[model samples]
Target: MLTILAAIAPNFLLILLGWLLRARHVLDGPFWLQTEKLTYFVLFPALLVTNLAEARLDGLPVAAILGAHGLGITLVLGLLVLPLRFLSPRLRADGPAFTSVLQGAVRPNTYVGFAIAAAIWGPHGVTVTALASSLVIPLVNLYCVTALIRWGSGGGKRGLGATVLAIAKNPLILACVIGAALNVSGIGLPPIVGPLLKILAQASLALGLLCVGAGLEFSALRGAHGPVAAVLGLKLAVMPLAVGALAWSFGLTGTTLAVTVTYAALPVAANAYILARQLGGDHALTAAIITASTMAAAVSLPVVTLLIGYLP
Candidate 1:
């Protein structure tokens, strides 16, 4: 238990610090916008590109891990979509919006997951997890975008070409593709290039977390507790459990299994709201779900750590 707490303490501390910074108004709106832009458009992509470019590809159960995480997420999302009665009139009004919000709630936060992996399992773990994330993030983003757009936008018809364009144009996806190409080509990063990438990768997590914390809100969840809790349960509990079982069934054990399950247990990506809002989904509800799931992950992540620690 002590070891588990020790592994997770840093992440929780960062969140608390970000919260405190917001409480003291150290982060203004413009600062947050800039921070988010830098994190998403530059730091995150650089991190993904660099980490994945040099990842060791030998003997990794890459497919099984990615499949397990995706399957777990899909199942949880499907279950969350089931129609439910909200007795509260206020909640009833917000319920549809909550569905889109909840989609973001169930997806893992890759930045935080990679940071935790580094702390818990060292640099090798970081590289492996980053590679896994490179595969996961684009797919998850597409899923969220598709779901929120279809559900919240009142069934607007979208062309497949536009969807493909969106995926192609996403900075994160583009970074991942470039990284994979570099990795497969067997050309090592040049001297200056490696350091430059490392600098960006290192800054990605802390800055991203700070902006995420600054964006957290309680009022969005106040009257919609039931749906929020439901999303949290699926995200923090159900998804990890499903990932563990599916990963085991597919013959993934040891570090691969540990990484997959731990990441699956991570909170929804903080950027989910930004994406939803950008693409015309329910922004307020997405914010609420992001806030609730992130808080719950403080507990859920430790539980996953213990599970992985005890793995045979």
Candidate 2:
């Protein structure tokens, strides 16, 4: 128990530090935005490319990871969208944005997941999970962006082709794809390229999480408690537990199992909220969900970490 607690304590402290810095106005919005952009557009992609470029995906339990992640998300999406489909006309207007917020609440924050993965499982685990995320992120973002845009646009007739094109143009997804290709092809980046990417990847964890904390909208959290509760319950508890069971059923163990479950358990990403607001989705509801789930994960993560330690 103490080992598990010790492993997770540093991550929780770093997030709290991020929140404190933002609360104290030590990190301003423009700075946070620029940092987040750099992380998203440059650092994270570079990291993914670098880490995954040399990975061997053979015998990696890719199916289990994919199954756990996909099934959990599919179930949560249906649960969120069905009830939202019946809201009043006026309230129904907010349904798409509201559903987008729910997606954001349930989606895991890969930045935080990466940081904790490195701390608990070291370089090898980081490399492997980076590889996993390189695959997972593109698909996840594609679904999220499409859902948010479609709903926010009132289900207007935008072709699926257009959505695919839009997702294809996303820089983050592009980077992940390129990285995964390099990994599968067994190509080695030039020495200079690898080092540069490594530096950015290292910086991404702290900088990204700090920007995430800075972006948390306390004002939006007010008057959204009931919806926030439903979102948080599914995101922090249900989703992770579901993933854990799937992982066990498949006989996954060691760091793969630990990282997989922990990744599943991460709070709804801050980016989800940002994307929601940008696309006319319910920013306040997204904000409420992100903030509430992130705060709750501080407790839930430790519990899951301990559970993983006990797994056969």
Candidate 3:
């Protein structure tokens, strides 16, 4: 247990540090906005491309890993959407709020997942983390965009084509595709370029965690208690357990199992709020969900790590 805490503590502490720095006015809103943009567009993608481009794919359980994780997410999407479809208009009336519930239930913080996985399992762990993200990101985005279109106010009118275009243009997805292509093609980056990308990848983890901390908003939790609680339960507890069991059933073990479950257990991504705002979803509820789930992860993650350790 202490070993698990040792792995989990620094990640959450960086989040706490970011929160503390923001609360003390050490960094203002605009700084964090630009920082987030830099992390999302430049640094994080560099990390993904670098790690994945150089990853050893030999003997990796790519099919089983993607299948297990994908199945878990697909099941969760149905679980949330189907019941909501039959609910009273008053409960489901707000399009944006419904979108928030969807985002909160499924999205995982890739930045945190990468950091924690690395801490626990080193480079092999990061490889599994990146691979899981490559497979999961597109599917999660597809579901969220579909929810926004079906339930969101004005944006739903854009139709399926726009949603497909948006997912295609996502930087993270593009990075994943490029990186995997390079890996499979057996092409390596030039010496100078490799070092530069390595440097950026290192910067990404620290800066990304801080940005996650800065994005946390506590006030949004005030009136949205019910939705907030439900999301935390789904993201932190239920999703991980479901995904872990499915992955085990598919014969995934060791680093692959650990990384898949860790990703499942992560909080709702900060980008959930951004998607909510852009698509006219309830950004406030999304923010609250992100904050609550992230805060809950400090406890939930250690428990998850221990549980996976006990699994065959």
Candidate 4:
């Protein structure tokens, strides 16, 4: 247990440190904003492209990983999010609120997942993490966008073509596609491009966590007891367990298994709130879910990490 704590502490502490720095105004708002933009567009995509390009994919259980992740998410949606879509209008005063809750439950913070996986399993963990991201990013976006269109006030006005366009334009997904192309084609990263991407990738983990911390909206949590709790339960608890069990059933073990669970255990994506606003879901509720899930994951992830060793 202590070993697990030792491994995971720095990542969460970086988040706390980010919160502290932001709270203290150590760096002004504009600097953090630009840092976030840099990490999202340039640094993190470099990490994805670099890792996916060089990863030892031939030996990996690609099919099992895909199955476990896809099935696990579909399971959750079938049991929870989808049902809520049918009922959110009558059951809840704010019908669009379900979209935020749904996003909170399924979408994961890949930045945090990457940092934690790297801390725990080094290069292999990061590779598995990227592999999971490649799958999870598109899957979650499709589900969330569909849910938002059905439930969010303004989302129904947007065409399916626009959603398709947005997902195609997503930087991380594009990086994954490009990297996989290079890997499959056996072309690989060019000598110069590989080294440059490595440098940029190296900068993403720390800055990404800091941006996560700085973006947290603690004030949003107040008076949002029910939705926040629902999201935390599904995201921090149900999603990881379901994904882990499915992955295990598919014969994943050791670092690969651990990283897959880590992917699910991650908090809701920081971008969900932005999506909520754009789609006219309850953006305030989305913020609450993000803050609540992030704080809860700090404890839940360590426990999950410690328990990973005991899995059958």
lDDT of each: 0.75, 0.74, 0.87, 0.87
Q: What TM-score should be assigned to candidate 2?
A: 0.89
Rank the models by TM-score, top first. Answer: 3, 4, 1, 2
Ranking by lDDT: 3, 4, 1, 2
Better of 2 and 3 by lDDT: 3
State each candidate's clash count.
0, 0, 2, 0
Error of 4 at 231 (Å): 0.8
Superposed model 3: Cα runs more than 4 Å off: 88-90, 157-160
| Per-model TM against the reference | 0.90, 0.89, 0.96, 0.95
| lDDT tens digits by residue: candidate 4, 196-303 | 999999999899888888888899888888778878889998999999999999999987898888888999988898789888789998988988888988899999
Evaluated against the true structure, the overall lDDT of model 2 is: 0.74
| Residue 111 shift from truth in candidate 4, angstroms | 1.0
Clashing pairs in 1: none
What's the C-alpha lDDT at position 70 in model 2?
Answer: 70
Pick by TM-score: 1 or 3, better one:
3
lDDT tens digits by residue: candidate 1, 35-57: 88899999999888888888888
Total backbone clashes of candidate 4, pairs 3 or more residues apart or in separate chains: 0
For the record, the alpha-carbon RMSD of candidate 3 to the native fold, in angstroms, is 1.5
